[model samples]
Target: MTAVEPAGLAAFLAEHPPFEALGPEALDEIAHDAHVERFDDAALIHDGFKEPTDEVFVVVAGQVAVLWNDSRQASSDPDDILGPGDVFGFRAMLTGRSLGPRAVACGAATVARIPASLAGPAFATRSGARFLVETMVPDRRATDVPSYSSVDDLIEREPLLVDPDTTVGEVARWMTDRGVPAVVDLGGGRFGLITDAVLRARVLVDGRSASTPAREIMDTTAPVVHLDDTAAEALMLLLERDAEFLLVTDRAGVLRGVVCPRDFAISPITVGVSLHEQLRRATSIEELATFAGRVPPMLGDLLSRGLGAGRVIAVYSGFLDTIIRRAIGLVFARHPELSVDAFTWLSLGSNGRREAVLSSDVDSAVAFDDAVDAETVPAYRAAFAEVSGVLATAGLSADGHGTTAQAAMFSRTNADWRAAARQWLAAPADHNGAMMTSLLVDGRPIHGDPGLPAVSRVFNDLREHPGTMRLLLRESLAYRAKLRSAWFPARRQETFDIKTHGLLPVVNVARWAALSVGSAVLPTTERLRAASGSAMLPADSAATLIEVFDVLQRLRLRYQIRQYGAGEQPTDVVTLKWLSPLDRSVIAQAVREISAVQRRMDNVSNYVAVEEWASPGRA
Candidate 1:
């Protein structure tokens, strides 16, 4: 027996699966304990039920055959063949099963033997453990659904429509006769949707006559979806706009049938129509609270049904937004003096990015018109307070960092917001400034003015300052501590906080890249897409980040759902024991990729800084 050179062994291990996933420190540990051995052709490396199985073997240079003694046919055929980078002999050890497989060298073979003590900690690097599990059970793959891939698949028939000259009474009569709740207005080369709610709010509630023109009350700004667009795209449009109907058109711009929430409500897990209808009909905070309680169960259902994490979060965020809007509407009804048009309510953080999980709190702010007088500010504050109380009752707490609309700091006029933005930009490294920039960078107006010009202005102004980008990058790096080193040992007693260690770092990176490129997009995936398209980040890097983000989010959601079902308060921490070996492996790969992306970003930033210093006037 000969001890292998640690450096050579480390290099060999770094090129293989599971070991390749380990950090340098873990590889060093393996290199320290590993020993090299050579076997002659037809020599038995291990005999079934006789030889000790405490050591895991990795083929270095030649092939070895793993033969099961229980079955004569298997002995003849061999269960598996191990070549360079292949590992073996750990399954029986981990599971406390008898050594049933015998390994034989096919020819002159070199192998590295790692003690169970060293090989055991390698499982802490999820990729290593997952590889073992996968080798043991090859049939356990993620289930696939026969989902509708395109919006055109959801199109059933042509939409009901009327000419511009049609009277409201006639349109109402036609809607009733056709058993439809809405109709498309294809008049004057424009596409519009006239819904029952629109008719009631604009015509009936406003005391307009039924004989008035339907076109006058129709919603002209209905979101449009292309025929080739995926069902997810159509659903996103409906959810984002809070629109009941989406006008579907072909690439030629010809009118296709309309898509309602019901059309895309094929997933029993999402139940989009049922949830939206209930939210729309709810008239009070208490009523909305009842619906809010359904979200956790719905999330559980979605994950159980194998829905993608991106879709689950988007659907949940949309539902949560609907609840928020309905609750706001109820407040407005109670306090008519508080004008909705005067203030824009922005959802910050996860809600802003539309990436909220079940455990998320309400992170929001209010931006008011400059015309709002000092006397009216208190009234607006009171209204926001009431809204926050309702949301709190409905299960969403005011953000722990104090970014909610309940605070006077977050509730400010457009002029005040701009001033705050400038001040924060000046000290981006400060705790409060970093927190504010992270939140406001993803601020999306959920209620009132959808355009959110004031919030947009703040982000645009921050992006204009190169120093702001530098500080943002620094802020993002602050969370780099969450990333686990390859050599870090896994904990058995404590659970890992996935939200903190997994999701936020990716979110912050995407946010910085997006803002540096002047992209005002909110969602993490969209931000990466925009940044990649603008060449602020490499396309491959952006794509990898997106994939890793998706993996982290999915694991987070699934873990939370399981915790919630166990009568526990759903928290961000996930017990590693609860995860399948495959899931753990996937998560490890994702985390490593994220760290790599961060390093790439650091390199790019440093290079740019050097170039700028060398050529001070160059763009």
Candidate 2:
């Protein structure tokens, strides 16, 4: 017999528990019979038919991923990630049967395996010997294992089914028997699924006859998904399709299964409904104020649901604004003489764009009608001021400009607001208006009727004024991304705030594009797409901006999920040090694209100047 090789197997034995328990002589003997193998990226490490042996494999370098017996048909890299020092094939080695799951090399790597025969007695006598036996002889065989793709896997597949001719009483009994709150009308192909919620909302609540056919209550047009789609993709589809249950169909549209919110949702819709209900139930401003802390947790959940950045912002903005509206209502209820119906409310900056993250500050304004004189305005002012204080007390940080609805300058009538805007446009260039305009440009009505007509007239006047558009564009173009040559080891260290580099550039450009073209959309993602038809932004740049914004928003969301898990609030200040090598590469590419667009914008217009007056040399 040929002599066994020892070094590779000895190393593998050192990492495992039972093998390490063996004395040095036995370990050396085991190593002699070991096989050392190197696998390149995407190379198969083992097959399912390989008989179970007492061999333990230790990953020495790079990574490996385990797959089921159907490795050829179903394989994923990093999907079943194993790192250095991690063991593989142990389950098979202990079981004395065929290896269960197949495994593959994720990258060029070396692995070493030791045979079971070398330590059969040692394994039987090991302290955790039961664990070894359990792993080796898995109760369920690999072939009998459930596949990831299934109707039941995606959704509640056995939903209550009723025949078209079944009486309403029978359908109800079926629901009761199954303990399911819903029933599906299987007679019609497209319109079948009906829920207990639907029963309550439409049947009982509407006083409709339970004897009616389920077709009347069933949502036949609900969207569906394929068994092959991932859980994450299924969740996104739910949001995109705006349906709770996604009807699972095969390639030929054959109804295979269904996926509902419970089937795949990482977060529940009941959370939002509950929060809205709580908001409605609060009778006092103080009670409403205390509920402010709850917003972050809810926003975090919505974001985790893989909801789009724009939709996340929109939904949360609506929810937050509702709280503010209720707070206003409570205040007005207490002060009946305050003429609450006479004014409109505005949410500026991110709140206006519905992009306010968990840490947003309040930027609001109130506009009154001309019916109220300056004297009556005092009561309005006092009421708004008190309300603003209540909001601040409720954890909404005050705006830097103090432009809450409480601010008298921001709180003005339609005629006064237009006059103020026109005067700002007509007056000599000043930093105050430029600074104020940046925030006001992104403003939208949050609590009251949006007096857009008044704001549009001002934008029109500003557009016609020479140097105004230039100034607006310049202001928009002022920020540039800061990139570093960090890939080179000897390069000087540098850090660029991604918020300023990645997020704000798109924000500023989108705002300018919207103002220039009379577009009123607030979110950066929405405004950039809307700007595509605008004459202000180059068509090519508008398209680029949209793609860039989407990428950044995705990056932001990924970062937000990580931060939320760590109990940190979401912000645009993504640290490069925290990102993986792949993410760093993506971020570099995204920044490069954004910078290219910025340079293109600079070439098209000389909107602003970057002159510094510092020391004598700098000056």
Highest lDDT: give the candidate number: 1
Superposed on all Cα atoms, the candidates' RMSDs to the truth, in angstroms, are 24.8, 20.1
TM-score of each: 0.61, 0.53
* Residues 1-619 of candidate 2: C-alpha lDDT, one tens digit per residue: 2222476557556666556656778878867666777888988777544645556676767888776444444434333577775666654554445644566788787776656676454543322232232232212234432222233354544555566555555677777777554446463355377656577777788887868777677666576666654443444445434564567766555566655543431112234534554665578867886676676666556555445555555556766676777778878888987777788887887778877665567788777877768888878878888787777766677677677777777788878877777766765266366666777667776555555427435765555665676777777888876575655535623444566777788889888777665666777876777666443455676777778777766677667667876888666677667877676776677778888877866754543232210001210
Count of backbone clashes, every candidate in sequence: 1, 8
Model 1 TM-score, 2 decimals = 0.61
Candidate 2 pairs with clashing backbones: 52-97, 53-93, 54-116, 95-136, 191-220, 224-247, 474-607, 474-608
User: Where does model 2 exceed 4 Å of error?
Assistant: 1-268, 428-431, 484-496, 533-536, 606-619
**Model 1 stretches with alpha carbons more than 4 Å out:** 1-150, 156-220, 225-245, 249-270, 304-306, 426-431, 461-463, 481-493, 533-536, 610-619
Report the C-alpha displacement of residue 56, candidate 2, in angstroms. 59
Top candidate by TM-score: 1
- Weakest 10 consecutive residues of candidate 2 by summed lDDT: 610-619
lDDT of each: 0.71, 0.63
